[model samples]
Target: MAYDNTPSFDHLPIPLTSDLVKTEHGQVVFTAVNGAGGLETKVVDLVDGAPGAFAPRTPDVRTVIDRDSFGRELRRRGLDSDGTVWASRAKGRVTAVYNDLSTDLDDAYTRRDDRLMLQFVTDPDWSTFGNVADGQYHGQEEFGDLLDDAGHLIISHQAADLVELADSIRATSSGHFESRIQRSTGSQSVGWSESVEARAGAAGDLEVPKVVVFRVARFEDFPTVDLVCQVRLRVKGGQLLLGLFPRPYEHLLREQWQTVIGELGAEIGRDIYATA
Candidate 1:
């Protein structure tokens, strides 16, 4: 015979105690032990039973994160103390520090955040959309060799306001950018869920410090099996936080990151991020 492993419901004499009393307003309340072994008082209000006194109530912690409340909508899935989103797929920090605004177009350069972004946006040969349109890498035997070169391509431009920049990108790019929240879904077996809205669209009325995300599928080697490439722009505290995320490791390679930056820098018609 198989040994039975069923749990026994025998009550232990641990001195369990509870208090039940009726209030002056003809309502009943009971004080008992909560799940955490702490004393708790709760009203046993029900349609069948006696109704407890109606009163206003404050929300608890569990109700905050579990529901689609403001707290749940504004917290990052994974973030550091410095408010930077780290990506292991890229094998380096994707974010960088913001410096003084540049007005000089001739001498501007790319920052670390922008450099990391180029890896996903530019072609394998580190060419921009204009270069590709101009046939810079057309019919070239070196195309395969350049595609294998992994590099960062950072492209950024300043605008008087975030709405203006977003409008410009929407006007130029094929896809229209919209304000939305990135909610985490799926089980742990698939992948842990996370929220990108906390940092991206948390500005509410203040359009200056907002987050904007866009999709980029221009590259040939963009992994179709993995998550799509998403570029996140966080504008806050009078600085811009730019980075690429959710890239699978197989797509990363080495190449010259500056080539694409210089190309876009000329077309953006504004100054680019330069090191101090």
Candidate 2:
């Protein structure tokens, strides 16, 4: 004879502890486990439960490669040819270093105490609303707005600041630039060097110092699947200045981005320079 059996609730998998709790103020707080194995609590009164809190973390050890080593790897990966990594920026004295996201995503993560920021830099003409009249400016405005929206979301979620250039500026040439330079103080600073250093050190094996810029295109049109372009810029005189151009689709690809970012390490390698 065949017998029928049913699953019991007592045998079902259940969490070890309560996932959420309501405070006297009517705010919902989530429970987490900290290093001490104690309950780490957080306020979850947000639509997305805090924005930047869940950004991917970089690994504690990363592959370390010099410019030459990086170039060889890029060639092996078919991302570059004939030692020409930054061919597009040939006139500019810069080289690119590529990091495979599949293997390198761990190097981008931040710890609980560490602070993260998303900075947006664009050319003055491209950043303004008036330039939207031009055909070339159509998608550019939406892209910038997307970046601004992303920044706002990040700030609201992570309680961080978004820095950008000042609006009013007098320039002699199109290349001349100015930045508003807003930063978080009182235990948080926006100086790029310190942040890079911390991120690089997160993985003891990662030696290359490069700024990873994540560029998203067609932001409004396809928010979910927006293309991401990662690039690194070189720092000169202990300072790195990026030019903002007004092109929506025109962006620095991953390979070129690495080359520009690789240049900054050369500056940091110099013994005479000092970081501000």
Top TM-score hit: 2
Give one digit per residue, the lDDT tens place, for model 2 in 1-276.
997687666643343444555432233545443424444544455324554554333322223223344334434553221112222222222223223223445555323221111112232332332232232311222433443444422211232322231111111112211222323332211123222333542111101112212323221211211222221222344333332233343344344344444453443332111112
Clashing residue pairs in candidate 1, if any? 114-154, 118-153, 119-153, 149-254, 150-253, 150-254, 150-255, 151-255, 184-194
Q: For candidate 1, lDDT tens digit of each residue in 53-107?
A: 3431221222121112312222423222222211222321122212222445674
Let me know the TM-score candidate 1 reaches against the reference structure.
Answer: 0.16
Per-candidate local distance difference test: 0.29, 0.30
| lDDT score for candidate 2 against the true structure | 0.30
Q: What TM-score do all the candidates reach, one by one?
A: 0.16, 0.17
Could you tell me the TM-score of candidate 2?
Answer: 0.17
